[model samples]
Target: MCNSNSLSPVWRELKRLQSTDELFEILSPQSFKWNIGKGTQILFWYDIWVGVSKLRDQFPALFRLSGKKNEHIADMVIFSENGLMWWDIGILFPLNEYEDLQYQMLMSLLRNFKVDLYKEDEVQWTHSLEKVSSVAEGVRVMVKSHIDFEFDRVKVVWNKLVPSKISTFHWLAIQGGIPVKEVLSYRNCLNNSSDDKCAWCLDHIESIDHILLHYSWSHKVWTGLFKWWNIFWVVPSNVLEFSVDWSNGMGIKAEKVWKLIGSATFWAIWLARNEVIFNGSYTCWAVIVSRIKLKVFQWLVNAKVCESFQLYVWSDHPWLLLQSPSFDMF
Candidate 1:
């Protein structure tokens, strides 16, 4: 009855959209609920129609014993000659004492439920009185549920000295929205790649933290920067924590320039990663460190963060700009 080549354009687009994880995560129990009618369209066990959680999660023992794991709600209900509705759940084996107790609980939960066999099921938006879903509503729910970062990172990433693109990248990186190998794997987009290993190290999975913070190449770049500032440093677990740690450690006078340098360091390491992966050209960590220093110097001079200073002085004694009373303009 159906062929992929003969699918309507809208239907094809819908199919493509269904494969994305964003839709899957957004349509969770917190934001959306099913208004049961006939229940023919809803999965009986896997869907969150019966209660706050999925039936499989709520009745794990019963779910494990179920033979008809993929049965629909309508299929699990039997209609008697007297117009009585009864469960027809297909269990593979008899329940033990604990599972029998769970079964009793499940039956009690479903005792007062009624199903209308004639009407179709509908998805209702939990957040709205109208029961209609909108992208704005979905985004609001997602942000409220998911975001748990400190507000200080926002100010750090949006520094006047950093380029807008780099600032945006840092923001995305902090949110785990960057399309690194680990993220692409999570989105099921890394079909061609054998594994999500770091391009530079080829040892660990290439998460944002591994590539930008933990890997030897990126670690060396951070170490070089710390040595340049003559500060003892311990790397944090992830980008956001690193930003907060770095900010908290810096003095009031050094914070602005240090934030700029931090942003430049992340950008340079990312560029080096892309160079290896896309251009098939490899640059060492020492070169990446040099690039970060040069790029930060350029950003400072162009942004007029302070009076123009010689590149040699920046490369050799960069902390002088932060420590010197004459360069207090920063």
Candidate 2:
């Protein structure tokens, strides 16, 4: 059998295999590849022969409705007295609604690749990189696939120049994962009405955003820091938004310094917030601003972005220090 009708014999044998068959288990990994030179060995439906991915994974909807779900490419290709004839499985399967029309488009895509009839079809392992695959790199790619990590602000949080604890705190604050009063209330961690109010402002719910950016006390801290930098920009509404967009429209060196500034500001705000909440201490705006100044300088010096600025000078004229010709020693 060398035509479409020959698929019935092969389909019968595949159906007879038990559930624990090793052949089925061999395809368990999430990736595989096919070198479809002759297209004789690759299964058209069950194998990841086309689309650089498994047809089962890429087009699950079409695969479920397909009648010849286990047919090989050779079984569907007709080599008659007249030459080779390509037969799409649409004739054997009845697809309803949009799938009926979509099947033709899919078939056209399959027809585009030129099949070399001389070379034998070979199976290959598909990995993320074209280089030799290592278990460590493979695990890294696999772990990354499961995370919804699309945020650009992550660079600011995981900056190698900053302290690890400070970076972690900034990451948590940006993600709203910190156990602030508002979040605790939402999670039912707070039991009394007294725990619902902001520790610093005592006006509204103490959300992470509110405590970090919007509260009257914290507003002064952010604005004063911006004033110290001589940047006349409007403050962003949330920590994530601020971290991602705050350094835009600056040169490369300036942006690096600005990112350190943002990270340091977040760490300082969190430290001040915790002090007021847990220690019953009042951290004034000026003190917080000064902490930010010192923190930024410490991180920047360690970052090696700028080499020759004295601490007193950076504190007095922060933006001027960044603008000085000596700052070009990045």
Candidate 3:
């Protein structure tokens, strides 16, 4: 059983040292209705203990009006000498700007769900039949319910076979989360030096699509990859389209290989870009193509996609493995 005074140790351990704002993220998805045994455990402002939503969410104007955003249920509720319950808004607390209807709604909700300080507050999970769930389970449920932008390319970016950092970088690039010059300009991080040009080509702005696809060096890298695979497909205009449409006209096994190799292609280009940006190294298209080949081979072999592929065969005829009769054996 979880401790009645606090959230479960497992959940708390996951967010033990986090700020109150961060704690709201963990608590928001946890369908925990408070059975207030002692009112100390219930957050008066932020908790969704009474209604279908948190009080802060239900009455944002009223919540902002109150000075005690973090006050507990016990702090707000008090008993008279005659044993009647009433709210105590605290000494000199600002309570001046909420609509009358909002206050009436709040009082009405509180009246229906009065807390008992004598009993130890209990937390119940509404998400589970057992009224208990782990932090990881809660997080999974929250993500599944709330996140709306999942895509196949994004899913490929989180492949366990790929390095997490590399996958995360790929995900960010796809989402345009990288701090490119345009982004820096938007955030007012750049001086007026006009240094936002693609390091390889001084013609256009250094957007993610330009850096990964349209720039002269990046184009060469993609063309080189296509030639290596014995495919003459035209490159798509964007990364997502490139990822999804790159494997067209290939067998299922070939498509898997193509997707993994596609990830390697993006990763290699980013590495080359970083090399140029950070180390002031030159962007050699041939060298980048070579690196992409090597990276794809390494990831394939290590991830057990092509465990038996010799380095020499992988170097010369990588696509042959994908088309081989025993390709599934890999």
RMSD of each: 10.9, 18.8, 13.8
**Candidate 3 residue lDDT tens string, 167-285:** 77777776667877755643447664245567767666678889988887888988887788677766677775565565443433476667667778888888888888899898689
Q: Give the TM-score of candidate 1.
A: 0.55
Which regions in candidate 2 have their CA more than 4 angstroms from the true location?
Answer: 1-151, 249-253, 304-309, 323-329
> What is the Å distance of residue 97 in model 3 from its true position?
59
Clashes of each: 0, 0, 3
lDDT of 2: 0.64
The candidate, 1 or 3, that scores higher on lDDT is 1
Candidate 1 ranges beyond 4 A from true positions? 1-152, 249-253, 305-309, 323-326
Model 1: which ten-residue window has the lowest total lDDT? 1-10
Specify the highest-lDDT model's number: 1
Query: In angstroms, how far off is 190's CA in candidate 3?
Result: 1.1
Candidate 3 local accuracy as lDDT?
0.67
Report the number of the highest-TM-score candidate: 1
Error of 2 at 21 (Å): 47
TM-score of 3: 0.51
